[model samples]
Every structure is written in structure tokens, then in C-alpha cells.
Target: MTRRWTHGRSMRHSGAACGATSAQARITDEAHLVTCPDCPDAAEAEAIPDDATTGDPHLIETLRDARDGHTRKIDGVVVDATTAHAILTVYDAATPKTKAKIAVLPLTVMTSLAWNILRADVKREGPR
Candidate 1:
């Protein structure tokens, strides 16, 4: 028999019970068993789509510029000017930690998206 589990439901494993909300649940072959993606027994790492980053020309150029540090101030916000696309807001000029923020934003956004084109790609194809 197949059992379906809903979000916010609890499942027991190894005499220990755990509950997972919708966002914390991961899809698995065993419908009766819901596991968190971070759990040790969860599914293997997902494969990244090869074209995830290079799918859009504009996104690619913006990413390259940010990577090469061709940054400047535009309207009080730090922006990458390599392609003149102004897609990424590296930091705000008013911030005291502008330099530190610039270094951190790219790393954080590298794991996430800083602009719409990249986000759209991820939404369409799923995360990398």
C-alpha cells in the first residue's frame, strides 16, 4: 500500500520521530517517508544543469564583470560596469563596510542570484 504524507506531518525513523514542514520536505520515492534534504539519509546531491549560468547572454556578461572586479559607483550603489548592464548592486555607498560588503555580496550571490535573468533561469530549470 502507498501512503501519502502532507506538509507539517511527522515521520518516525530509527525510533526517533521528526516533523517536516512544506519547505523542509524533499521528494522521495517512498511517499510514506518524508525526509529533510539536509538529513543524512536524504537523496544524493542534485546535478546542476550545464547551461544554468550561460543560458542568458546578458546574465553571463553581468556575472563576468562582477567576477573581474570592474566595479564603480552608480547612483550611490556599487555596480559592475564591465558590460554596463548594472544588474548587480554590490554595495550601498552609505554603508561603512562598503569594501567588506562588496567582497561578501558576490560570494553570497554566487550561491544565489543577484538579478532577474539568473533567477528566471533557476525558476525555469530548478537550482544548480
Candidate 2:
């Protein structure tokens, strides 16, 4: 005897009860397979609560405070104090072109200048 199959019954036989609204059905020698391109994979689908916080204001504020509190130092000398003072002093005394050049000095050279200034090796003369 032969049996006739309907579309819904065939979908049920394929073991895909998730619904066939946007699914593609394929028949293989071993079994029938139904795959939906829009559906997320079973292992990757995670349930998130409606009240879950995507971005916490308190966490953002804490991170900003931590970043602000961070003090950058090179060889035990503070970059903001010694290096900044020397740069500002020179910038104030420099011509417009020279001031522009001083603005782009790399961090390594700036730190070296700071080290020299702290050691009294770099001398500051009267404004020219």
C-alpha cells in the first residue's frame, strides 16, 4: 500500500515544528531537512530580560572618573607637571612658527625634555 503526504504533515515528519513561514525544506536519502535563514541557531539564541541594562550610567561615570584620576609618568617624573611646565614655558616664549613645531613633539622626546628639566641639565634663558 502507498500513502499520500500533505504539506503540513511532511513538515511535521521533518521534525521542524517551529513553523514553515520562511523555511526551506529539502528531502535527502536519509531524512528531510528544513532550514530557516532568518532564524537564529539553537546554540546562539540567548534570552535577554526586558529590564537588562545595555549601558549603565553609573558604570560609565566610574570609568570616566578612573580615567581622569590616572596620572601618566615616565621614569618616576609626572608628564603633566614637569613636561607640561617646560612645554608651556617654551611655547609662551616661542615665535608662531616655532610654537607650531613644538606642539607636535612625540611623547618620548617630551619625556626626555622633562627628565632633563627635572635634573637641571636644561637651562632656561631670558626671552629673546
Candidate 3:
């Protein structure tokens, strides 16, 4: 029987869990992780660098949609908001050469969704 995700249920048993290494939930299936909206492994795979001066908190503040828990979808798949915000932080911090590499990723689809969020934030923040 193929299991479908129930909206109200937790994703802990959905074969989509991440960061927990017990053996069973380690999830080596790359394809499912790629497609699963709530997959934290996918978010971790994107891997944002921890640079002290990246100005991420400001950027995070600027992403009001992410703060509000709004959904950002990529190819009809809903992206976790914290993950999306983290991606935006990566984008904001990347160097020109590094950004070129990141811009072509499937995960970069979040950038499009983020554009609207950013514009709205800019409007609210008032006159950058």
C-alpha cells in the first residue's frame, strides 16, 4: 500500500524525516527527499555557510512571508518556510562566483517565491 501524507499528521513517519540518525529514519532515498515538501534533508543538502557578517538576521527580518509561515512552492511542491528563508540567507551571502553556482539549482526555485516576499518586505520597511 502506497502511503499518502495526511495534512494534519506529523511527517515523522513519512520517510521524509531528517537530521535524526537512528538507522530506520536515516532515509537514503534521494528521489523521495528531492520531491518531499517537508524534507529537512533536502534543506540540509542545500547547506548554508555560517559567516558571521552575512547579515542574515536582517534578511530574515526582510522576509516577512517566511516569518509569517507562508508557504513557498517550487514546481508545485511546498517548501518549508524556515528552509526557504535559509536559502535566501545563502543567496544573500554568496559571492558572485558562488552565487552563479547556486542560482542554477532546483532549490533556487525558492528565489522566485522569495522575490514577492522580499518586495512586500521592502514596501513595509520603507525606502531602502
Backbone atom clashes (below 3 Å) for every candidate = 0, 0, 0
Worst 10 residues of 2 by lDDT: 43-52
TM-score of 2: 0.29
Best by lDDT: 3
Cα lDDT tens digits, model 3, 7-80, are 11123244334334344444343445333455544444323332211223333343446435864334323456
Tens digits of lDDT, candidate 1, 100-123: 444334333533433454456569
Displacement of residue 109 (Cα, Å) in model 1 is 17
In order of TM-score, best first, we have 3, 2, 1
| Candidate 2, 1-128: lDDT as tens digits | 33222223233254433454333342222222424443233212211112112233232222223235533332222234434555555556668897555445554564465456545633565346
Better of 2 and 3 by lDDT: 3
Give the root-mean-square deviation of each candidate in angstroms: 15.7, 22.4, 13.2
Candidate number with greatest TM-score: 3
- Return the TM-score for each candidate structure: 0.22, 0.29, 0.32
Model 3 scores a C-alpha lDDT of: 0.47
In model 2, the runs with Cα more than 4 Å from the true position are 1-78, 111-128
Question: Clashes in model 1: which pairs?
Answer: none
Off by over 4 Å in 1: 1-67, 80-114
For each candidate in the order shown, give its overall lDDT on alpha carbons.
0.37, 0.38, 0.47
